[model samples]
Target: MAALRTKIIACPTVGEELRSLLPDGFVLEMLAYGLHNVPENLHAQLQASIDATGPEFGTILLGYGLCANAILGLNSRRFRLVIPRADDCITLFLGSRREYLRQLSLAPGTFFLTKGWIECGEDPYTEYCALRTRYGHEKAHKITRRYIQNYTRLALIDSGSYESEAYRKYARMVADYFDLTFEEIPGSNELLGKLLSGEWDKGFAVIPPGQVVARDLFYGPEGMP
Candidate 1:
């Protein structure tokens, strides 16, 4: 039998991590990080990408989580779709939904950061800086505080895909700027590795062709199973 042809569609926030483990010949498409700001737009772009994928590929591996229901209705037209069983990219970084929940239990108000997030300027610190440019320091500070008022800690997830010194420095700065505690946590590529290697196990949702993604695939009706 011929080897299966696979492609990867991923959010930019988790692109670097996925790329680090991607096998040769597998095509990877990194969508805009900004799409995350609106789940509807993200859903549309993802569906469009999936729809445009050629029929030659046997499988599409999505490097995404439920993502605020963005994947809720994504359809797999002619190929199987594999998605991580996670709430968001944070679970991808932390390696599993269990670890993500454990960390959340420790600090429900914690904010997570990764190399991709820092490089993309997707964190609150970047927003604060941008706002400061438009509204000056005092006003920007107030607004930024209001935005992240519930966050008590800033965590940098080190997935070991790359060196962390620089990203850690930035995370620390952000935490200090916001008067939040800063901590470095170990991250795992285990989930991404499993996804890339076809270890679909219970950690993933393997959707058949012609099927639309449903919330129950990632979580039960009440929430995470």
Candidate 2:
């Protein structure tokens, strides 16, 4: 049999994490962040990337969660699309849906941060600053406040792979600036590792050839693939 041809098309956050773990011969493509605001455009771009991969890779592994159904109705005619059963990238970073759920239950009002998210400069503070710059201080302050009113805590996920004093300090500073309860949480690469290792379980939604990815796949087997 030929080698398992695989490509990981992921959000930049998880894509950067995978860069350190994936072995030789894997095609890795990291898409731009900030597309969360435009789901339709993001989905189109994602599908374009998938289709652009051509027939060289037999499998396309997505480094994303449900992500507001960004991948809903995506057609995977060229190769099978395997995605982790997650609501968002937080689940992938935390290692499992259960852990994410626990965090969710513990802190319903949370702003999750990671090294990637921090380095990307797309946090709420950044948005606030951009808004302040473009829309003036008063308007920016009003909108930014309303934008993040629901979040009371900021939890930084320290994956232990890319820990740096600089990022941690920024995280703390953001917490202070936002007046949020700051906490540090451990992150795991177990899920992403298994994803690159071709270890498919019920936690993964494997869309075979000839079938487009449905919204239900994001919910796992119980939700249907």
Where is model 2 poorest over a 10-residue stretch in terms of lDDT? 216-225
Candidate 2 wrongly placed segments (more than 4 Å): 1-4
lDDT of each: 0.90, 0.85
Would you list the clashing residue pairs of candidate 2?
none
Q: Tens digit of lDDT per residue, candidate 1, span 96-209?
A: 888999999999999999999999998898998899999999999899999999999999999888999999999999999899999999999988999999988888888899
lDDT of 1: 0.90
- What TM-score would candidate 1 get against the native? 0.96
Write model 2 residue lDDT over 110-151, tens digit each, in one string. Answer: 899998998788678888889998899889878988988999
TM-score of each: 0.96, 0.93
The per-residue C-alpha lDDT of model 2 at residue 15 equals: 86
